[model samples]
Target: MNCWKTINISRDYGTLRLIMFSSSTVLLSFLFYYLVMSTIVQTTEFTQFGFVTVVLSLFGLVLTHKLLHCLPIWLFGGRAKIKISTRKLLFPLMDIKLREPLSRNVYLLALFSPLVFITTAGAVGSIMWPQFLPYFSILTSINFGLAFYDLVYASHLMKAPKQCYIEDHDEGFHILIKQAV
Candidate 1:
């Protein structure tokens, strides 16, 4: 099947909405760090290695997100495929495409697994490592900020018709609802 033939659902989701949504993600990420880290740790000092640690931590966070998103989708058998789309530029966008459409509930489960685990882990890490608060908060914010796109797609999917299935693309998703026979 030519995947290109499937409908690109992002067009209908509105640019303004996405912009606002993405901006909110970034704002919240920063605010969350400010609120949590500021109150708990008054000051933090970091050397050059701290910068390196932030970079590495970012890479790890993205990998963790991808792993969480991919594992559940792949669990649906071999119908799922992972592809890298350069359209995301330096971020290295990863898309999980499924040949078979899954139920809305299943898709939601796969989508949120990363957010749930990663956010919780970040909170715990931040609390445990007050000395490395900057690093931890930066890593947490980056993870959440980068996940803006995921939140967008999830927003669309959440409103999709019950029978519709979603196929993730780097840019957006294909919402497919089987036409009446």
Candidate 2:
């Protein structure tokens, strides 16, 4: 069967949702960090360089996050081919594509595993040094934004029958439903 009509990433995630969610997440992150989490922050003699390092770690977290996301893909018996591709200009971006089709639960697990693991670590670190709450929250918020696409895809997958196959492609995913013989 032709899988062309199965999943269209562009149509699924259009420009409207992009502008709305991106702006909303940033605004909410600032508000939550200041209004809610600001109380938990403990004063410290954190140096500018220290803050600089913390900020720089966000970039490292991008790689770490991707790695964590791939753990399930590999453990669950899927192909995890890591590749580096350039964006609009010379900016490089790293991606890991899965060649195997994953079950609904497995796909969701891989999609959200990073969020749970990273957020928990951030929480522990925040407790050890509350002064880093702002950075942690901002980075966490950005991670959530990055995972938004997966969340939307998961929602789309929910429409499929219980016994369905989901393959991760460059544009998005192709959901194949298995029929009872």
Candidate 3:
């Protein structure tokens, strides 16, 4: 096997740029989600959570998003190591290290599962519980921001050869191709 490409999005795209993009995504998605939900629900009363509750809820959402990413991999019989740590002594970070290479399709599925699942849940929750639409919109927008990196990785994987495999490493992901004998 030979590595056809190595994609380190943070290194290639610059951390600042990625952060800016993610921030923009969060703001824009929140606006769009709230607008759509309000139009659909026609709710005059919106429930608000306390600051502590909101913070805890956001943390839970982040953990749920990470778990969703790992779910597809586990279902496909893939192994991954998950490490949880704190960044800046306050923010939590979860790093998922793949144990082996996966087919492009499988890797793509893993990448996208969180975004699809979380977004769908948020949408449905907003519809079913119209009074909590604001909370749902916030969580969904935050998840969208978190998913920006996955979207970037998936975009790169989409351009690789159909038979290629993806391996996650410290720097980023590697696209590998089998060499003909």
Q: Top model by lDDT, which number?
A: 3
Clashing pairs in 3: none
Highest TM-score model number: 3
TM-score of each: 0.72, 0.81, 0.92
Model 3 has an lDDT value of 0.87
The deviation in Å at residue 16 for candidate 2 is 6.2
lDDT against the true structure, each candidate: 0.70, 0.71, 0.87
CA displacement after TM-score superposition, residue 124 of candidate 1 (Å): 0.7
Report the Cα lDDT for residue 136, model 2.
70
Give one digit per residue, the lDDT tens place, for model 2 in 1-181.
3332244434256768776897687577656754565567665644233767876787788888888888988888887877878878666698878877778777778878877887677667766777666677777777766666656767777777666677877766787765434
lDDT by residue (91-148, candidate 1, tens digit) is 6776667677676667877778887787777777767766666666666676676677
Instruction: Pull out the clashing pairs in model 1.
Output: none
Report the CA-based lDDT of candidate 2 relative to the real structure: 0.71
TM-score of 2: 0.81
